[model samples]
Target: MHDHRRLGRELHLFDTDPLMGAGLPYWLPDGAVVRHVLEEYVREVERAAGYRHVYSPVLGKRELYEISGHWDHYSDDMFPPMRLGGGEGEEVVLRPSLCPHHALIYRSRSHSYRELPFRIAELGGMYRSELSGVLGGLTRVRSIQLNDAHIFCTPEQAVAEARAALGLIRRAYDDLGIRAARYRLSLPGGGSEKYVPDPELWRRATALLEEVLDGIAYESVEGEAAFYGPKIDIQITDPAGRESTLSTVQIDFHQPERFDLHYIGPDGGKHRPVMVHRSIIGSVERAVAHLIEAHGGAFPVWLAPVQLVVLPVGDAQEERAHDLVRRAEARGIRAELSGPGHGTLGARVRAARLVPYQAVIGEREADAGCAAVRLRDGRRPGAVPVGELLERVGARAGDRGAELWAAA
Candidate 1:
């Protein structure tokens, strides 16, 4: 229910075309950069967390989901099957999640107990069938690029993996200046109709969840879990009392077994491994929506697309301004030259659209070969070498590390 209309329009970050099938966001040039910045940051963080990245096809064979228990257990969340070949014949579904594919990958190789803990990360674009009323802007959408990972490990390794995931989540939230966030310790099935078959496994799973949650003091309630597992949700409550879950770490005891996945034990005997499904930043689209609302259109210098715009005060200073632009570009700074959009130097600075930092290069500053750099922080680092300014932005980028490894 947050009003994103103003930010969406003013920033020109996203466009929702009614004719292009609503709920799909059209990322304008600037918006795409923001998206890439986030995606790159997250990929780097996940790579450092002992995760091996993988790519999977969006469409899957029907048998794959059937063996993974997704077809029978969580059917409501998936998009309808696409019929391939000659007629309305064979059924193949657009994957709603990446667990089944990752399961197939594990089964593809015979794993050993030494590889007991294997994490696979995939930045996959998934499709879902959303209710009509729920589809609007980026909050609820039909398509999403998700930070999907599946951790295969022995039950004993669960706690360590879960703790590491929590640390990453916290780091991300802190870097983004996200406060007022907490974890919802999702309990295992409590004999409700909301839960699935297999009561004994549910009890064992809940016990595992309790063990992890107790250590973190994560508050939990019953019946909040997926039919197959217990999960920890990272979320926040806004001033309007509306709550949103941004990330999830689920301990699944059922899926691996459903697919009959196993690893060779030290005894050379076959043993089942547990699966932990997680998304630290959840969906890129939804996270952007959260940030758009949370920061209220003021992205930090780290994530800003066009960090600075150089405006030459007069025609005589064009060469100097262009030189500064090249210097900023070399440092990976998204800088631009202000053309004839504004008549006067003062007007150009005032009308610096979609750009936070504006450097005014007149005769005096050009002679000094320095940039009169302005900060989005409301202070100007006047007369600075382009290299010095790049160092400052680089430091800020490192500080604003992605939300996945940090927490939502």
Candidate 2:
């Protein structure tokens, strides 16, 4: 099995320390670079899809979750409330989820029917209190940076919005090279306390999700649904063949009622809006963990921590290598210079094998103002002009291409 924990440490991607606690691993510089690129890509996609981004506090008052039923139904996985000053001070807790805060955002102002399908997105942090034994690597963590969003739309618009969300999830999976093991229609199980007790609401919400998943192959799984609603879970299998959800699309009717969310209808009366919750990539940490294992640390060109490494064969070529680094950086490539001090040309190339592109500036190539190029896949494109090299790399990274070179 290609375990991410092993690969992450080998690649200097992330680590956990005893002082910092388990399941709270911190990202190394290389890992941060990959994560930043992934996050920016998600933000750009959401912005283009009409989602208005927002920032919300990670701490919410106890009453906030109580109103959303997290305090009642899901408090075991939530951190205990912290009293601000003394015992009498107001109680606040690290939020277990972002939906409550987003519900508050939706009720901040009255809206008209035209603005019914208002979408809000955030790459924000939330905390979960997990049992010590179950916590492992990035997959299960105490803190999570979620790629979460909520779509507030009319009942009539709910299906279309949910279907669009599924489409978006598929697009993201394709770009990220993630293969879905299966789609699961998660429904409430027999435990009444595990889910909201409104049978009619559950029925309606489940039907809406079923419609959104129309013609899609999925297994209906009881007890896997969110406490407030049913959802479409996109499941991915790890190298060990263990399956877990990586993305989800859900229809929520409960939160709108809890928050009293309404918009002016065409009949000049207030009508309730449905909340469609979707996450394209569930958590930044888990997503990167999956990517690390999926690619075995040789990430796609666009997401690679160091896209290009410029190597100088000897002291004579150091100046040229430095110049090439500067030019590549100017072109938005994550370029670094590995000088002769690192080792022999072959040794340095081997050291940076995980890097997508390696441009070797030797005596002959330096004089010719070109580079002897080698790809991570062991393809030697031979000597290519410096300008052309930078352009090819920049274009490939920008396009998020899986192949290092255009032709291949």
Clash tally for model 2: 0
lDDT of 2 by residue, 59-174 (tens): 99999999999999999999899998878899999999999999999999999998879999999999999999999999999999999999999999999999999989989988
lDDT string, candidate 1, 1-408, tens digits: 445555766787888887878667789887788788888878888899899999999999777778777787667888777788865678899987888889989999999999879999988988888888888788789888998898999989987787788777777777665654677877654556556677788778777767767756567767678777778898776546667888888888888887889999999999999898888788998777777777666676677777778888788888888887888788777878885545787677666643656777777888877678765545666776656555665555556643211111
Root-mean-square deviation of Cα positions for candidate 2 versus the true structure, in angstroms: 0.9
* Model 2 misplacement above 4 A: none
In candidate 2, where is summed lDDT lowest over 10 consecutive residues? 399-408
Candidate 2 lDDT score at position 147: 99
Best by lDDT: 2
lDDT to native, each model: 0.77, 0.94
- Candidate 1 lDDT trough over 10 residues, lowest sum: 399-408
Report model 1's TM-score to 2 decimal places: 0.92
Report per-prediction Cα RMSD to one decimal: 3.9, 0.9
